[model samples]
Target: MSIPLALQNEKFANCQESIKILYLVDDNFRCMCDDYNITKENVEFFKQKTEEDFQCRMEYETLSIELEEEILRYIAERTDQ
Candidate 1:
């Protein structure tokens, strides 16, 4: 699971403080979406531009490995199922 270089520099984690990279990938290891905490307000503002099924919420803080892992797990679990 290699992350994008642009996303890599987009205010993500340092294995210590917090992780803010939201990597929304499809089944083929391709990123369907990517966003960071700093840009969440923008996401909310422009969310209506995207389609109905596609959604990325801002309820969760973007500074935790658990959140990243949870999203990965969700992708993995759903794809596997």
Candidate 2:
């Protein structure tokens, strides 16, 4: 898989890269579903997955700008906390 564009740009390295940092969340979704014997009717797993995929793609599309904005926002947010 390709990395975000903001990561590719050296100019925005300090600001963007720092904010673009995402910790890969451990999703045991498949294991959970199997363990629980989940049924589609009881869970909207597929829908949630589709939504996440779309959001990720959108993020990837505007990686540079979004990452820069996110980094700035994160820095500002840190001050408030």
Candidate 3:
């Protein structure tokens, strides 16, 4: 199976399988993963900008963190099932 973009983070490395399973079975989780990956890509793109884009980068970074937390929470909830 192809790895989900959100699972590319080292933080989620160990739980990739679990998250992938949830990604396949849950629509909401799949959406969150998609959002997370997009936000992550935005962060990377912003990182290449000049100093004036620092705030934008920070904002994207914060959003990515929130998405990561939500993804983790969803995975935890499903794993406990």
Candidate 4:
């Protein structure tokens, strides 16, 4: 007995869908690995670096505001002189 053409096409379509699903999963895994630094000498290295970078940025913004205030004060003082 021979399989019907419609049944064979349906099977092929199912296989293609399965392949597409696998590709999607593989892509998602690669994206996650890239985001988290999948390979490292130390497991905490990326986390530590991210935290340190955040702290440095916060400190920099605070200092920048302070510097701007000081500059404005200096300009006002010189204008009054």
Candidate 5:
């Protein structure tokens, strides 16, 4: 599936390539449902989804940084041995 330009340029840019497509799909789905202002429940649902996506992105970044650090540490230890 083709990703939306906005998502490709923004939301999915920092994600690992293998997962970028999935994030794009989620983003597009969220955007699609965001245009209607018919009900409180819809707004709440979208809001909750946005918050969840934000949390997931934050966790991914944190884990990526931690993984990089661990890899670097492992390499250093190997070099010193």
Candidate 6:
């Protein structure tokens, strides 16, 4: 299975196995991973744009962080069960 960009972070590097399991079995977690990847890509795209796009980049960055945290929380909750 392909690794999601969100799971490539040091914060989640150790949770690969758990992530794979949850990703396959949980729709919400899967959606969060997809959203995280998309937001991450948007952040990278805006990083190359003009200063006018700085705000947009920052917004995406913030959303990306939120999504990352939510994904982590979900994984933790699931794995603890």
Using lDDT, give the best candidate's number.
6
lDDT of each: 0.47, 0.56, 0.82, 0.61, 0.65, 0.85
lDDT of each residue in 1-81, candidate 2, tens digit only: 223332345564666533333312223533443344345433567788889999999888889788899999999989974
Clashes of 1: 0
User: Which residues of candidate 4, in runs, are more than 4 Å off?
Assistant: 1-43
Clashing pairs in 3: none
Candidates 5 and 6, the one with greater TM-score: 6
- Order of models, best lDDT first: 6, 3, 5, 4, 2, 1
Predicted candidate 1 versus true structure: per-residue lDDT over 1-81, tens digit per residue: 445444454344452122222333343323332343336546756775564334333333444567898889999989974
lDDT of 5 at 49: 99
Kindly list the per-residue Cα lDDT of model 4 for residues 7-71, writing each as its tens digit: 23444575655544544567664354344443432456778989999999999999999999999
Please, what are the lDDT tens digits per residue for candidate 6 over residues 1-81? 575866788888788889989888899998899898899888877776756578788999999999999999999999974
Q: What does the lDDT come to for candidate 3?
A: 0.82
Clashing pairs in 1: none
TM-score, predicted candidate 2 vs. hidden true structure = 0.28
lDDT of 3 at 70: 96
Listed per model in order, the count of residue pairs whose N, CA or C atoms clash below 3 Å is 0, 0, 0, 0, 0, 0
TM-scores of all candidate predictions against the true structure: 0.21, 0.28, 0.55, 0.46, 0.49, 0.55
Count of clashing pairs, candidate 2: 0
Model 3 per-residue lDDT tens digits across residues 1-81: 455675678899888778979888888988888888888888877776755588778999999999999999999999984
Enumerate residue pairs that collide in model 5: none
Model 6 collision count? 0
